[model samples]
Target: MGRKLWLTTSAAVLLWTGAAQAQDAATAQTDQQDEATTLGEVVVTAERRTSNLQETAVAATVLSGESLDDRGVFSLEQLQFVAPSTTVQNYGQGNFFNVRGIGKSEATTAIGVGVTTYRDGVPVFPGYFQTEPYYDIGGVELLRGPQGTFAGTNATGGAVFITSRNPDFTGVNGYVMGQAGNYDNLKFQGAINLPISDTFAARFAFNSEQRSSFHDITGPYSGAPGDIDMNSVRASFLWMPTDALRVLLKVDYNSLDFGGYPADPALATNDPFEITANGPHSGKDETARVSLNVSYVLDNGITLRSITGYQDGISVFSTDLDGTSALNNTFYDRVEEEVWSQEFNIVSPDNQRLTWLVGAFWQQDKVTFPVTTFPEGAYHVGFPEGVLDYYIFGETPKETKAVFGQISYDISDRLQIQLGARWSESTSRNENVYTTYPAFGLTLLQNDEVTAEKTTGKLSLNYKVDDNNFLYGFVATGFKMGGLNAPNFYVPASSFGPEDVVDYEIGWKSTMFGGRVRTQVGAYYMTYEGFQVIVGDPAVPLFSSIVNVADETVLMGLEASAQARINDWTVDVGAALSKSELGEFYAADPRIARSGTCNAETGPASPNCLNLDGNTQGYAPEFTFNIGVQYDVHLPNGATLSPRMDYAHIAESWTSIFNNEALGDRLEARNLVNLLLSYKTDNWTLAGYVHNATDQTYIAAINAGLRYAGPPRQFGVNLTRTF
Candidate 1:
């Protein structure tokens, strides 16, 4: 099946490329009267400055605002299909992101997930608050591999950078958009840009959305419609006090409130009625950031830059996972984080020679997780007599300091080499306590601290095949620091170690048919050591422990993507395949020693299992593919018509880290179709769209004892006017 799909996709690409070539010839002749331009070049701030994507020499995916608008994408979760070897999952209320099949599960204070997120070059949100708000974003950049040199720490797998829209100084502009559709849904969004002076400007934006639930609560409980409300406002000012100095100040705020269903228990014999009703969940996130950047142009053709930033945020969620009739029977979790960082770099200005960037970075963050389980009396009914009632309260504080540098020198016109390295030291302090609970035999109740330091490096070589084509190969090493874990039923103490990976990749990027078609292909081999795994500890009663399972993993994969414009229509297709395996394990801890040797063959729940270590790496799909096509037609009445279709497929996957058993393994593949019809004039535009046209029913997430279903079909029409 995989081979056949690949062949079909290849044939489609060839046909589209041939057709695009033919249209390019005609378009060239028409350009004599009016100039025609291709897609706008993408510029990203991944290296602290705006640089063209093609010259960055990194495996990155750039999504433009126009492209996002055309696809009707409004949130970060919808961007999963745009990048290869990437997946997003929802664990309860928090969102988990994975790159190259490496990510964490329910535990937040662990070294498992190696990904990090940044907003406008500032790190605000911590690992506990991964489900961040997405609003007023100008564009998003996804760096596929490690970004240790430029992105500071915690970017072992990769990094995601979001750039919001800044104030415009050109003129006064604003737009309003509204949508109404089935399921009693309504949405409104508006943005305005104002210019105060030639050097100062500001922009403001806001959005609100509400919808009714699709699931029916037929039992005793009553279910209501789910709703989402989000508001964002931002202002930016550019000040120039001297000829060689420029200061830009930006301030933004965002808030999100969502009431939705909770995770459902596992199905019994395929019975759909076992699912629970949509619950009442509410969450709010607010962030404030300030950045100061200064640049100096020296007389000797050298440029020096300094960037400093500070960020603080608070996130809270109040949810009722179990729709019980008892009052205050809910679960609430809140996280507050503050981060500060600074960097200074120097680069030599030259067109065709050596370019270097050296900088030092320091960052510190403090995150507190206070969880309160209401109506604690109900939880102690099953316990022994005289047991005290209590809840979980934990706080984690982390500090990191690092210095990194990168240098790129052209050995010759056809050959170029780049080298980068970073040295980092980090420390974590964990304080956890159970208040109002009995101290006797309470399992885990203590404070834990861990610290680690490491140095990583990367090397890359690129060879130019021609003006429009290049071949590159690279070897990079990345690491994630170890951390302390909160006391729980399964773990008496934190049992984690630093996770590291060495990746080797070779790829080619080419533009063919007079820049009408673009293609990229890559192959990679990755070796990981000290892989983190979640294990149930028998000594700690009911709690589970996060530890570095004594096992190695080898991953090999191939990825290919192509885009072509055939006349007025455009098409994009991509696919990836990977094979991962776990190596032999040696007994290290006493628990494994008591259970015989680590190589023993055992059942899914056995503690001595070793050969199936790969299964414990949750949410890693072996095969994935995405196909999309869009067509646009210009009408005679100065209107336009566009239709788009996108389909994503994933092979059966193991939902749990232990791979004990597969849930929703044979479920139906996701097929989503979207339609848009729009009419545009000089200053006004109107459009209508039908999202999830099929109204397909599928599980968005499935775990050992829980399942989460996706949203139903929705249709809405929107109108926009610019002044």
Candidate 2:
């Protein structure tokens, strides 16, 4: 099946490349045709400074707001189909975005996520808050590989920048959209723009959606699961006090309720989506954020900017743990997180040989678990006698300060050199008390603090071979701070050290066929040290722990992407090939250590250990590719007709560090296809779409001895009206 799919995709690519056509002078003169070219120039504003994407050294997959809506890519999970080398896996409590075999794969907060996600200009949301949908956005930029100088610490994997639609000083304008789909789904998303005054403009957007349960709960479940109820509202105001000064403020809120992801005993079931577990099942997330951005341009053409952001998020989850209607197997957890951040920047004017940008950042956040009433962020099982860690009440406070800068100097008309660096310091304090089951053992920690400091840097050179071709290469370093774990009864209180990574890459960008075809290709190699991973503790066997494998892990990959436009056809093809190898390391197998070992209260240093020298990283697919095609046709009645198709595939991956297939830890490769048809006029558009047209059933995640199924096939129609 995989081979056939690859061959089909290759043929499609060859069709466009081999048959590249040239348009007549009269046909090329039309603005409509020029705009239809999918390979048009785009300005990447999310970087340290605004620059043409085709001229930059970064490897990014950018999508406009219109393209996102047309492709029905509303969330990170769906985004993987359009962006190569990206992965999103939902683990019930939270989901994470992984890039190039890096990022967060564990469901714990003991260590920070490797990737940085920026909303507007603030890295305010990760984990559960990341599940929020996207709407009324300007664009999304997914930068692959380490972005140390750009994103600072905790960006070993990559960075994602999401910019929402901003209000313009124009007349009142906006668009409304309504959608209906299978599984009794209904959705409404729209936005309004208001020009309050000559100097001020405002934009308001909202989204409300709901869907029926996809799971057939045959067992004694207390609440519905595998359903969606999402609502969000956002308001943005842009104020220009003077021609040289601007101030923008944005406020956003979300109340998302995912009735919970219930799992069946995947080992005994053919249908991973159908479940028979019984317990109160609910997955609710509430988040609110405020961002204020102020900027001013000086007489010398330099710019000064300040960004301040605040966020508050609360998540509640409860579900069946064993997933087999077990007598005493359920989990209840609740967590609240709050963050405040500020950043200031000084950027020199663009189009200069000596361009530079300097910035400083500071952030503080607190994570709390309401133990008396809410059970959150942990798993425990019972056998009619006792359960491990009945009550865990804790507070984790963290703060970070950093200074970063980048400089670019043109050595000649065809060559440029760039250098960047960031100095970061972070502190984490854990104040918590842990209470065990049946025996009622207690572990307490009062204001224990750990500090981590790192200096990361990047160096690159860009050479312009000609007007339509560019070559670039760079080496960069990334860092992620470690933190103390919550104390458990059987294991000693421990803390992991920070992890570091160094990445090397080279790339080429080119345009051909009179700007109709644009292509980018890159290859990267990364070495990781003191890699952090989450696993069951050998001491308690059921409790989770964070550990660092000090060996030097290696990762290497190659990526290629091309966008083309011919006549009325638009096509995009992207593929990534990668290999990852874990360094030599030995540890007790958590699943079996309880039954054998010298010391029952030791970890990694026990007499008997499992050799995990060459295991593959979890969720790191060996290959991924995406192909999209669309064509437009003019109608006789002054309307336009369009049809689009998208295909994507993810190679097989493992779910655990052990990589044991017999233990049900391997995830099979998956192929997804989507179809869309649309009719458009000047003021309105109507479209029909079938997402996941193949309806392939695949394991999306594995945690706590359970597996989750990805979303099933969804067919829907959408109507949009513009004022």
Model 1 TM: 0.87
lDDT per residue (tens digit) for residues 426-526 in model 2: 99887764445645545455457899899998999999998877999999999988878667655567888888999999988876666777777788999
Q: Relative to the unseen true structure, what is the C-alpha lDDT of residue 610 in candidate 2, on a scale of 0 to 100?
A: 60
Candidate 1 Cα deviation (angstroms), residue 268: 4.9
The C-alpha RMSD in Å for every predicted model, in order, reads: 4.6, 3.3
Lowest summed lDDT over 10 consecutive residues: which window, candidate 1? 376-385
> Candidates' TM-scores?
0.87, 0.93
lDDT of 1 by residue, 1-723 (tens): 478446644754575567556654644644423223244456677876567665556677777665666665676556666666677765444566777776554445455357777776666555655545555578888877667677645776678888777666779987887878887778777778888777666677777777665555433332232455556566666665455666666776666555444445544343332344333344556666777666786777577877777877776654344333332234445666777777777776757478877777777777765554442212121122234333455667778888888888999897889899989888888766443355454534667788888888789998877776778899988888777655554335654788888889888776655555566677788887876655544344244455564667787677767676646667776666766666553322222334422322232234444345444355566666776677777788666677777666665555554454433333334555556666676666777777666876666665435565666677778877777
Cα RMSD for candidate 1? 4.6
After superposition, candidate 2 runs with Cα above 4 Å error: 1-38, 374-389, 436-438, 441-443, 536-544, 594-608
